[model samples]
Target chain A: MTATLTQLIPLTPPANPQLQDIRTQAAAYLQEETIPTNKNEEWRFTNLAPLLAQTFAAPNQQLPPVNINGLVIPEAPDSRLVFVNGIYAAEYSSIANLPAGVFVGNLAAATDAGLTVTNYLGKQPGGEEVFTAINTAGINDAAVVWLTKDSSYESPIQLLFIATVDDAAVAIQPRTLIVMEAGSSATLVQEYLHTSIPNHPYFSNSVTEIWLGDTAMLNHTRIQDEDITAIHIGKTAVSQSQHSSYTGNSIDLGSKLSRHNWEIFQIGAQTETNLNGLAMVNGEQESDTHSVIALTKPHGVTNQLHKCIVDDRAHAIFNGKVFVPQAAQQTNAGQLNRNLLLSPTARIDTKPQLEITADNVKCSHGATVSQLEDDEIFYLQSRGLDVETAKILLINAFAVEIIDRIPVASVREKLAVAVKAFKAS
Target chain B: MINPNSPVILSIENLTANVDDTQILNGLNLEIKAGEIHAIMGPNGSGKSTLSKVLAGHPAYTVTGGKVTYKGENLFDLEPQDRARSGVFLAFQYPLEIPGVSNLDFLRVAYNSRQKHLGLEELDVFDFDELVQAKLDIVKMNPAFLSRSVNEGFSGGEKKRNEILQMAILQPSLAILDETDSGLDIDALKIVANGVNQLSNKDNSMLVITHYQRLLDYIIPDFVHVMANGQILTSGGKELALELEAKGYDWVTEPQPVG
Candidate 1:
């Protein structure tokens, strides 16, 4: 049946008893929350008509083996989880020997002895969001990760979600849940790739929920490079305990339409958080980023930098919010959003907001949108570089502010190449 | 116009130009020949810098009248990049700071562009690295500077030296040093003078624009010209730079007696 977020999603009984109430709550929340329109302050610049107008059905198609041939990650040599059409494909997957307390496998093939996930699964900061609620209501299989106390993984854990060509106008809801116990550390790399059937208009409504215990840390990298025929809306929710730290680098380079939401909560004191993101779009593509950092405890610290490069007739939007309440005195927070418009027709809208009630805290937020300077162009041209090559060099520099932060050498190199190719196209 | 059969590298006659509705260069005339070094001395607002920019085809400076012949071809006809490829180089008074592009990579691209213009094969990264390191000695620059962004976070003196290093690599036939000694200390000035001296050969020429005579003392100009409003007020030998340095620009600003 053709459906929207307003309609009921049919699902079998929950195999894990813990998810039953959460699913019911999500269904009720969907009924109460209306889909955000452009009239809403948060969605002022981003029109969701292209996404809402599409008639979507269930994603049940199996994927072919074409995803594994050219896709590789040298940084993540330990394990690989390939999800095709939101289902785990074991034939194209591998797992190296893991530590005693570490578990790496499919989420649907539930192993009960691992760390507890029921406490964090489906628990997102914006559980009432229209798209997030839809993901909770429709998701059955997820890529889950768990590490026990005092355990650390040297190599990265890679999760690749390849959205296949769906016969129906379908929305693929792929969920990711990672839980780390006290004193544990791990690196997770999740890449969203789509092999689109032309003119299909597939939608990937994905969500990832992460929980870190006291003193735990995680370096998470998410790269979304969907095909132009696809609509990608993903949300990453992170909850950190006392003394825990989180570093994330989000790189968005593709998709006809994309909206990524990041909600971070510093529930415990003395936590540190860093978020770096880059979005490069061209043609008629629209990429929007919305982030929120809520520090409720004292002595929390955060550093965030988000940049965007809009070309052709594409539009990019950024909305960042940082909240430091009275209890979070002595918090230090900073946020900046920089945008580069490559053409006269390209557009960018940015809003960086801060709500701080703590008198002793220091917080700053700003946004800048500018075109390529003629002086800079002439400078390179004077050195014998043609105008186009000079623009590419400047564009690459604009993105390196975020791409250089990726610790994985292979991922960084691939992104550099992708940035160059994106400028040419 | 200077004779095309001779070795004149640049000839400017009756040049009139402006930037933003303000006339800077009016009826400026000069002639430069190969194997000759010309030093232009002027006060503040005397069109010294404008002359260099107009010669290099800066877009901001509009030439209303007059003409410039570079290597016997119309200089205004070529784009700034083409002018660079044809061996007309300008060391900016304040070089631009380009972040995220390594200095070595930028120099290599620049060098290869000139080589390609001459129909020579371009060098690869390894070969270019070796060549760039050898040229760094001219500026007394450290190899570590190559890994940094082009002129980004560099000291004022370092930026000037990088400019000279580029001049060494490009080996342009007509090089204009515009206020290259503006923000340098004694040691940096000596290094810059030494680099310019090394690159100055009989086959090439130079135009040094400066307000002080300290730079000329080291580089030793073949001819010195005093510029007042828009044109060269007086022309003489190297001793003229020492005369102006001692007497100040007041002598040049005043109307001179009829010859």
Candidate 2:
């Protein structure tokens, strides 16, 4: 049996036609784009050795059976898509009462049917991002939802992605495209969870691209609370046209090494965008978030606020940048990052950058990192609470501003429960 | 029928303190009985404020010599929270503005700390709210202020009122009002003094440290001591305050009688 298993393993690279072709293409891409080093500006302060050292493997073709009961959203909308190991699970999905001309299906099926895949696929710029390139190349299947022009949907479409394998290293590349045409409005929720047992190691690489036409509105929410042993890299790119509005609230709770990237481009005038996020990390976990908002046209407005609470030797990093072009007169942008360190060893590094070439624009950016105030703690302790209780109350109050901004009540409640439990423990 | 031989509630003996190596309290000595209101009238740099802070365990002040005893216990051995829980209250001259801590929550914690120190059952949220609301009337404070952050965006009078409100809820045995009347308008001064007077009983005593004698008019003290050069120059009845207000500290501060 040992000899047979050894013979089954390829001596060099697989000789199968499809496998060989894929390896050759991947090798060529890897050669063209060398791994980023410390000298690279975008990769500064972020060491990628943990990600680069891992052996990459494709997602399993036959996904293991998963229970959808634990993944249900109370009072869920008519349309929902569930994906496991980058493959769509139709038995766990629902798309009832979808409006006419709305398209919701798998990316592979949409491409095979000759749907408009080229218009949105790979449309987002992944400049100097090797992980994004790898995700783009490894894209096997994805969930794509497109709304027709002048159509509004009352219920939000929910997408659930779960990773449930233990120790057997796997990579999940979930690509999503949400297009809202003129006069259309909708909400999209993208949730990621890990059902794997404790101490299991996995990787999740996901990219979502969103496009909004004239006068369209979209509310996007992304929640990541996976097992602490998993590594995650997620990217969200949005493009807004004239008079369009796009808002996003992202909450990241669990992961051993997690980094989220958000990039928004305002291509037309009078576009509005609001982005908010909260990251809670504890127990040696590290979470990093990077965001860039670019105003390419005049009369664009953008606001962003990101808060982080790091405890128990955990570290959090936030880098936010806003750029206003020369033609983007009257552009208004504001960004702030506030962090609280609970333990003495917990660390937070925040940098807010603003680059404006327009003279008539209003732009401001600020970042602050500090421990809880002693006076505040004493004030609480003086009331009857112990020192630990006082610290928890003040820390919770610090995070309340960001948590209250979550639009989804159920998700907000879930996040609150996680925070309370974390504090208790 | 007051006990003339009763044990002292608080006694400071030759207490010398320094801030960043600059000596502020140079061998200061003071004492308070269980039911008496003692007013310390002093000029600038007389260490009146330092006395209040050293008792409250403010981190900035260092006691180089001497000791402070509260209810027969050494005050220096206790942390600030412990001292506070043991019924030692300091009404700050300038209360800090904690932006996110609610006023009601602040009072509740203070009240609970005392209860826990006394080994009593703690009050629930509903009961705590009711208790705080009842005490708010002592300071003539608005109920809306309870929802706001502690001392945040408050006027000078409002901050002082909030301090007294905390005192009423905590019900400390020995309260130190550190220049609490400095920034108050006439109306606010009356309100604060009245609140302090209401909270004082036979079981609780107060040490009023002030530069002017205006506050003593409302909360009339049983004994008045003139503090000069960090030591009590003289101690007398309430009439001593009238003398200080009329002639100012410069007059009595020069070669006066000690008794």
Candidate 3:
């Protein structure tokens, strides 16, 4: 039966120009690589049987209409961008008073404007994955943002990517590219929201690539909250230059089966990067987040912290790796993963690894999975808080270390509300 | 019928509690009325802190046999939160540090819980800020403390004062101070004691548990009870603390005449 099932699995076909350029490229790559079965290192804890069983229809050709009023930012409203199914919707987007020489728009349009699209597209590693290849191939539209040298955008740019589909078993791939020129600084928020009812099966595959030039700084926040029956696979790659700083905050709250891959490369000296992530899973949800920070240059620093809260029969997995090459002397890197299991049935698998060949580098990695502290809960309850309220409070606090670092207040408030609602549900 | 004029708000009858199957508070009995402060003094392992834990409904310690009545209600019948909402507070000896929960949010939730239990309208952020600020003054704590994570990096004294701040905000009918003075310096003790004093009223009572009488010096108690071997050996007026302070707890735990 297993052999028959394996044989029955459909393999992605070779690239054909007749097909959508994105999809053709993805299918060709997928055809060359093996499907990630349980034997694969990354797929050991996650099963793909459920996803393979369903027939996924491509995203609708015509963009679905979205209501601008529904995209309210409680704190900052003027600095926001709206997108539906990977296509930028200019009518709903608002970006007031952008800095000089800064360009932000749809990737296809940006390519038409003579921007360097081919130089950065598909440049990050791990594009060999079938889901990534599918995303590359099927991407209908994408957000392309470029910041010129010496420019600084005071207000954060909020990108609201909403997935709306009336049809069943549909899929959407949203690609995003952010490029910061030398001596530039900016903060950007990318939020993935799904407005679908429970038990409505859908799929969303997304890829984001970020490039920072010399002496540039970038603050990036990604919030993912999808429907319960959706499958989400997201990947973000960041490349930093000399004296450049990059900070990433990723929060995952929804999706039946979700996985996020974060790969950061410090290729220049004096580069600093901080990667922080938090995931809250409940019910039968299974979420996995894998992150890698490589320091290939001297005098670079990197810090990574990821936390997870698993409840009910949910499962969470975290794998963090820090690599310091031999020439990357004076490198400093640290990784920590903390998991809180609310129920005995809930499971969490965490692995923190550090491979440092540079003797002068300081590298450390640690992972811990623990339940809510009884003493802390008792302390709160003693002050009039009930068990539920106390638990919520503790969980919120546990996630705050990363949420509070969000550069955008409006996005932060939305995240806070979402957390409260999750606890209530 | 319960007497409205009665001074005692809490009455323990043959209370026995155990931790990990070992008896701590063995057949202990004590009483404290409103407007009066009582201190429980004992050596280590004498179950001074265990009494406070039992009163607060800590799950770690099991009450083998006994009854604790607060305000004419069976204290053990209510859950920890219910006990708290019913105006029973335990100021822990070691205050926990909640790294991500801001002090303001923690206080607001605690305040709202009490209000909800009382069927009163919950205070909004504006009113809660005002209320918390007013209480902060009593403890001499700075307004900056509100924005920080609860006891995340606070000093020993700050933690104790934060505990008192919560006690003041909750305004419980009975406050149990379990070793509140264990790690405080002179100034922090005074500040914490002053906060407690400002909150105590004619309708509320306090139980101060300590190994030293120095804490009672600042927030003087009206009654002093010597607890040894899990039972109250003696109870007397304020001067009894001075006597115990002079002669030490060994003097009281010695064989004494039964009344």
Q: For each candidate, give the TM-score of chain B.
A: 0.96, 0.95, 0.95
Which candidate leads in TM-score?
Answer: 1
Regions more than 4 Å wrong, model 1: A1-3, A6-18, A112-115, B1-6, B21-23, B246-254, B257-259
Task: Estimate how well candidate 1 is docked, as a DockQ score.
Answer: 0.66
Candidate 2 residue spans exceeding 4 A from truth: A1-31, A65-81, A89-118, A145-158, A187-189, A282-285, A310-314, A341-348, A417-425, B1-8, B11-29, B59-78, B109-127, B228-231, B250-259
Higher-TM-score candidate of 2 and 3:
3
The 10-residue segment of model 2 chain B with minimum total lDDT is: B1-10
Write out the backbone clash pairs for model 1: none
Task: Decide which is better by DockQ, 2 or 3.
Answer: 3
Model 2 scores what on Cα lDDT? 0.80
Index of the highest-DockQ prediction: 3
How much does candidate 1 score in TM-score?
A: 0.93
Superposed Cα RMSD, model 1: 2.9
Using Cα atoms, each model's DockQ against the true complex is 0.66, 0.31, 0.83
Chain A TM-score, prediction 2:
0.90
Model 3, residue B45: C-alpha shift (Å): 2.1
